[model samples]
Target: MNKLTPPTRLTGWGRATASGASVLPVSRGNIADAVVGAPERGALVRGLGRSYGDAAQNAGGLILRLAGLAGDAVLDTVQHTVTVGAGVSIDDLLRVTVPQGYFVPVTPGTRFVTIGGAIASDIHGKNHHGEGSFGNHVRRISLLLADGTTLEISPSQHTELFWATIGGMGLTGAIVDATISMLPIETSRCIVDTTRAHDLEHILTLMEEGDDRYRYSVAWIDLMAKGRHLGRSVLTRGDHATVEQLTGSATSSPRHYDPRVVASVPPVVPVSLINNLSVRAFNEFWFRKAPLYRTDEIHSLAGFFHPLDMVGSWNRIYGPRGFVQYQFLVPFGQEDALRHIVERFAASGAASFLAVLKRFGAGNAAPLSFPAPGWTLALDIPASFSGLGEILHELDHTVLDAGGRHYLAKDSHTTPQAISRGYPRLAEWQDVRNRSDPTGVWRSDLGRRLGLIA
Candidate 1:
């Protein structure tokens, strides 16, 4: 087996925490050997590091970067599925599949994430209210267990292990490959409708009443707005545009799916560009830019879904201290709790330009999946903000009390108690995980912090 690289510091996308781990590249041929030789601290697979927290960080241990697993993707159009290496990224996948008239079943805010990370986090997107999470569409998974054994698991075979590995945060094993059902699309554009909501209640009413009509929906709220303007948002809902909807040049090449980075943040940003004053101004402009009510506006898939991806290394705008992305889900009846949290953030002058709210549909069988049938809100706040930890901790109580839970993939502030309260099926998942990893061979900073591992 090739030697592991010297210990190197790694951090999740949020960049709030960093740890040192020896990293190695492992293909299917050498993965078992890599796991067998893992240090006493154990080993965990690392993907694109898109997770906002420590889930992919294995401090003082080994981090395996999956490589050369079955090579290029094998698209089976007949079955409407793609069997691909877990290392394949959504960005790369789209470039190939979109032109071929297919799209991933589910995609989060960004397309830079890997297939393995999507399954591990069981990532959801705006259309979650209609399509469920990524795991729901997965037909099968090739997993490398803790003891250097490989197993092909599906919903019907090794059922318990299959669900456990989904959203198990990589503790159950290293995912090598997967077969996922794909969505067929006629073009790379979305026929979007935009509506500006004046307050929290207005936005909630709009989404609750009309979300079911669209395949994808999301609302961007101005968290800095106060009182009458609290939770003021721009709601955008849409579905893939059919070829008939395209005109002129678009019609000539409907599936042309090349997305590019339009701009980039400099490497050295000494301090955060975000603050109450700046965010307030930006919020006002953002709100005014959207029409009070607009319909059938054609938007590129990247523009509508992963706008942040257009600005390369945009996280650097938060400066050297980085930022924290706090995302939580509240069950349907917990609208009161959702309102209170939004009110709190607005009142506190939390400078978050990226606050968004979406309604999730029924969750899958994954014990640790973040989405459920409820409202979910995600926002990014500068970590250097004063009393930020205390505020988030206080909100955790409200969330848990309302039968809501924080998303582990985006978590950096939630505690072990909060996690326990959030995921009732956690212990059941642990039971399956422990059985598969009897020697406790797989580990990560998140697993340790959240008490996911004994």
Candidate 2:
């Protein structure tokens, strides 16, 4: 095993809550040795560090970087399935699969995330309502337990550990690799339908009625809009375009997949770039730019699923104070609570540039899984905003009261009390984790922060 590197500062994609840890980059062969020899603070596995919070950090202890374990994706073209190393990124996988007429069944907004991080977070995307989170498509995971034993876990095999590890935030074990089913696509384009809703009610009605017809759907809500315009949004929903739908030059190369980063944010930016006035103006321009009703618009896979990926280090735009990404889900009937939260953001003049709203389908058996049959809303707000902490706390209370829960991947400020209230099955998950790691060898800042483990 290699000696740990000098302690270095690390933070989530949100750039909030930075911490220092002794880091060790490990391959599959050396992972067990590093974990078993970890210091008193224990070890946590980190992948692409796309998590918005500290889910991957282990302060003062050994931090395992799995990027060395990455290898070429193994694909079964006929079965539409793939087995990838822990560090294989979604972008890397797609670059190979998309050209061969296949795509990831589910992908979060960013493609830079690793396969291990995706499973650890169980990320969901626009198609979550139709398919499910990354966990649903996961067939098996190779997890390295605290005792240095590697086990291949599936839903029906070692069921307890499997479920616990899905959304357990890497508290159970280190994920080495995963096998998942992929979605077959005829072309690397999406035939989308776009519509602009005047208000929250209009957008909700449209989605509730039409979402079932589409394979993927999502809305960019204007949280800065107040009064009657609260939650006014631009809804874009679509499915992979069929070969027959392609026209002109597109028909010649129907399976081309190329995503490029047009620009990157400089390392430093002024914190004031995202204030209320700027955000409101951007929102207004975005809302007015979309057609009231447009159908059959051809969009690249990257354009439709990951517009933000077009700009590298876009989070840097939030500046030195960093930002907070608050994502919460309320049950289907809790539309009132969703409305209230939107109202709160609008009334408080919160400058959220990227406010997304999506509908979730039934959640899987994973106790800590974030998705449920409900309406989910995600917002990006500056961490330095005055009263930001209090606002988030109040919002947490409202969500919990409505039988809602927050996404651990995006959470930074939620209290242990809110965690208990939101995830009632957490105790069950903990029990399973304890059995797999009796000495609690697996640990992370997120686990300690939420009191998920002792």
Candidate 3:
């Protein structure tokens, strides 16, 4: 039995009477017990619910919360690497690495995600044009399989499993530890240069024309901007600052927390995120504030790498119905198809608060890895979108036609046929998963949705 057991009640994610998620709150000590005795053929591994969709949701299956497993990040400046436990958070690692003048090779838009979350997502960063997804920099991974033994995996060792795990969305196994490269930074501050584009065409031109010049760059696309300004965006680029560049915050990792003093004002408050008027207002301001194709210099890595982390419970702004982040990739060869999608959204007025467009350079050997050489777009829409499923279904068709795929980490609405059509390597991924996780002991809403398990 492994002396294991599940929790009695769920906590933090949702406080609704109709929430079907019956996750009992398990402690760190008893976490192992949660999945230890799962004789069932299927199970799901979950970390923080930070994953935007059903990627972390298992309607009725065992969920091993890796975040509750352990949190440790040992940085080796000499080796330019960090060996970390799966539970460590990006924020936690940043707090330690900045003093040593190193940073994560890849990071999502926010710092609240755990290292395990990053691995599952195989998150890319602003520099994805220059760098690839995080998986590229991973030197190795230690996976705890359902059979309960840890496998040291890399491109050369257990090659199939390694790639499958990179963007497998935790369907492969429970990642226990990982060794990843830490980028060298002269200073924690960034010399940011901001520019705005009035339309989608300009945004693509800006990225293709000068993306390689900076270490990192990202744009905020105004989904609500219509007509002449459709796909309007503000592009921000930056490189790590040098000692001479820092004005007064000479400390390596400068922070951006003007709203934190009042942080305690709403401290300990559980904020709801799904609402209408609020999102409408937020989207407008976010779009109107940027310069129309101009530039500006900025500071602070916190704001540069993760602007959303500034507010503690920013997710609460989404309200009760919650939200879903739709992130998908469209290869260079499929620009027309991708453009059609954007055009469709523009026509329908699918207002989104956050819309990011990036160009990814290469992909992992992982049979199911999300990124391929392509242009990926991410948008946050209310889960309450009446036609969400239909819209996403349509997008899935577009992604497949473009020879691109969806990141399982941000996916909850994709279909099996779409996945099969999108990833030509899906069969190999299944073989690897079956070899490592026979009996389909790992299952999730995402898995069930896409029929990862028969």
Candidate 4:
């Protein structure tokens, strides 16, 4: 077993909530040993720390960070799948697979997340309206349970446990590795279509009318817009470009894929630069810069999907108090609830610059998965804003009443009662989790706060 590092203070990508835990670097070879010796506080596996919340945190417990999990990425061209160690990140996976004319079946907004984290969180992307989330494409998983026993699970094997682990928030067990079905692509670029919507209803109607034609779709909303321009947005939708769509030099190496960080935010920002005035100005500039309607515009994959990744430590812009990413999903037939929340944000001058709106398809059987047939909106707000807690808590009631739920991966607020109201299958999932972790060996701060464990 590797030596355990002293208790280290760790925070999520949002840098809002933090906890201290002894971090131990464990590999496939020594994980069982480590699990057998976990302390009374129990243990939890942490990935690259992108969860924006406390899902991967374990206060005063053992935090296992997988090492040597990416032993090798074995690609099976005929099967259109790749079996890789769970510790491998989507960023590294893309660097290998994209060059081979393939892409991940689903990816979140950022590429820095580990495959283990992706599966645990069941991340969804802009393409979710068609392809579903990451768990949908996963063929199999190697799970290390609380009893120090390793099990190979899939849709048809240990079926219930597999689904429970999909969005179980890493409380089910430690994911060792996985085999994922990859998407075949002709090029590493995308052919995009852009449109500017005048208001919330306009954008929602446009997406409802035409989203089926594209494989990926997302809208960036201007929350600061009010009155006639409430929810004004820049909608971008597209799919991987074919080789024929490339022009000039790009056509020569259409499959070549390389992404690099262009800049970084300094570490010592004292106050959040994101405020009402600055966000309003930025939103205006963003809305104006996008073409009124542009089609067939070629774009690199990195530019279209993960533009924020280009700026390293971008969260630092939110300053020392940090920020919270509140994402909620209201099911179909609940458009009124969605509108009410949007209006609330607009009226409150929330100063949210990164508001995103997407339409989700039907969700799978993952008991804890966040998405359903719904309209989901995600936004970031400075944590130190006055009366922020009251505003979010009030909104939680509205969301729960409308049969909506919050995303645990991005949640730093929201209460246990809210979670119970949101996920009807919570008891079912907890039963399965408890049976596997009879002694409550696998645990996390998220689980305890949300009463996920018995």
> Cα RMSDs of all predictions?
1.3, 1.2, 3.6, 1.2
Question: Which digits, one per residue and each the tens of the lDDT, describe model 3 over residues 52-147?
Answer: 666776654555665532235788889999998777777777777777778889888877777777887788888888888888889999887777
Whole-model Cα lDDT of every candidate shown, in order: 0.92, 0.91, 0.72, 0.92
Per-residue lDDT tens digits for candidate 1, residues 188-285, read 99999999999989999999999999999999998988888888999999999999998778988999999999999999999899888898898899
Cα lDDT, model 2, residue 237: 99
**Model 4, span 1-454: residue lDDT tens:** 3356689998888888899999998888999999988988899999999998888899988999996334388989999999998889999999999989889999899999999999999999999998899999989999999989998989999998999999988998999999999999999999999999999999999999999999999999988899999889999999999998999899999998899999999999999998989998999999999999999999999999999999998999999989999999998889999999999988987789889999999799899998899999999998988888899999999999999999999999889999999999999999889888899999898888888885
Model 3 stretches with alpha carbons more than 4 Å out? 2-36, 39-41, 67-71, 249-281, 292-296
How many clashes (backbone N, Cα, C below 3 Å) per candidate? 0, 0, 12, 0
Q: Clash pairs of candidate 2?
A: none
lDDT of 2: 0.91
The alpha-carbon lDDT assigned to residue 97 of candidate 4 equals 92
Global local distance difference test of model 1: 0.92
Q: Model 1 — TM-score against the truth? A: 0.98
lDDT per residue, candidate 2, 206-282, as tens digits?
Answer: 99999999999999999999888988999999999999888888899999988999999998786647888888899
Off by over 4 Å in 1: 1-4, 68-71
* lDDT (C-alpha) at residue 102 in model 4: 84
Question: Of models 2 and 3, which has the larger TM-score?
Answer: 2
